[model samples]
Target: MRTRPIGPYGTAVSVIGQGTWQLERADRRTAVRALNTGIDAGMTHIDTAESYGGGAVEQLVGEAVRHRRHEVFLASKVRAANASAHGTVAACDRSLRRVGTDHLDLYLLHWPGGHPLEETLAGLRALHRAGKILHYGVSNFHDRHLAELFARTGPDEIVCDQVLHHLGDCSAELRVAPACLARGIAVVGYSPFGLGSFPPSPRAAAVLDSVARTHGATRHQIALAFLVREPHSFAIPKTATPSRAEENAAAAEITLSDEDIARIAAVCPVPADDGTPSSASGRRP
Candidate 1:
């Protein structure tokens, strides 16, 4: 798999990672096999969340990585509701237990929430100091939220900003991505295929088809390749079967040419933002 520096820590992580958002919908044994398959394919970055399947998926991930944990860069998120100074720590503890790990490679606040950002930071900082988590970041935070965060912390203090970025939704590219890129932060694109809503426009479908043909790849693989084309960007496209996992992992090997990227850009321009959250996946837990 291709690799990129995840944060200021300069940790090299797989450009294409495994996302376990709804793995519970699959049979437990199958889900575990899929994760292992992706890992074996060099997708060493595994992301899970406490909110996903009410923590069942985390346990599933735990079972998958139990023996090969050292080979994986595991990450998990604390729900916004549990992002307070106390709640963040408590939630991480439970997540650690569920994942059967002593420490997380990365931890994140699910999104901006009612709690003061400082409280969330305090908890994350505490975790870092105590060696509970090696790095921390935020998901679904916009440029404005990032500015506020940078006020209290250095740009490097936060490693990445996970957001909704795909062929159709380039809202993050409008501001969030530039802001992060300026600060040497990684832009981790979740739901890179737009939550199974790929080709948000007819023109996009044509562009993807043409590009896929040029590379002898599927449109889905092309979409994943597009998201990680940039040096500072990473993608975590989820799958529940070993076949799909291998297919997703293969995206890291397909490099889009300049003409391919330009064509995609012309056909799927960033849509005008309606002042809504970048993610189509609801932010609230």
Candidate 2:
């Protein structure tokens, strides 16, 4: 898998990262196998959250990668309600203990909430000062929130912003994408396959089918290819099956033509409002 520089942390992550959302529910053997498969496939990044399985997922990830921690970039998030400095500091320590790591490559605020943004950012800054986290970012933030964060915290302090982005969900394109592009902050796209809702339209499916036929790839590979094709973009798709994990990692090599990209973009309409799905409501994982 090809790797990209995430930010000032100098951590190089795979283009296709693994998302550990439902990993805790999988039997320990299955979880270990899937994670090991991902790592062997050159997937150097693993995204998990403290809220996932109420901390079980982090524990599982910690165990799976303990021996190979240097080969992977580990990232996690603190819950939205726990945005305060105290809460964030405590959460960071808990994540470290669960992951069996001394420091996280990247730490994120899972979601924006009622807490003062400055206070939340200050908490992350404190963690950075203490050498608990290498970099800090946000998830599920809109353009306004990003701007607020940039203004108060300054541009260099924020590393990246993660959001739900797929062929079917282009809400980030309106403001978030452009803003990030201009500011030099990488955009981490989660659920790049539209959460399994692929083939954006009949037209898109037709185009991808032809492309896949020529490249000997699956439709899912074509979908993920569309995401990484974007500059400074990274994708993390969750999967428990080893085969699916391999397929997702293979997407890194499936390059698309300009015509194919245009055709897919045409069928997948960019939403006037933010493309975040209404069903996206859930705890971070």
List TM-scores for all candidates, in order. 0.95, 0.92
**Tens-place lDDT digits, model 2, residues 1-285:** 888877545567798899888788788888778888999999878999988999999999999899999888889999977878788999999999999999998999998874888788888999999999888898888766876777887657777888888887877766787787777777898877775567767787887788788789998898888888876789998888888889989999887898878877777767666455332322344
Q: After superposition, how far is residue 32 of candidate 1 from its true place, in Å?
A: 0.7
Tell me which residue pairs clash in candidate 2: 171-275
The C-alpha lDDT values of all candidates are 0.89, 0.83
Residue 169 in candidate 2, Cα distance off native in Å: 0.6
Clashes of each: 0, 1
Residue ranges of candidate 2 with Cα displaced over 4 Å: 8-10, 273-285
Model 1 off-target regions past 4 Å?
272-284
Q: Write the per-residue lDDT of candidate 1 for residues 11-32, one digit (tens) a residue.
A: 9999999888888999999889
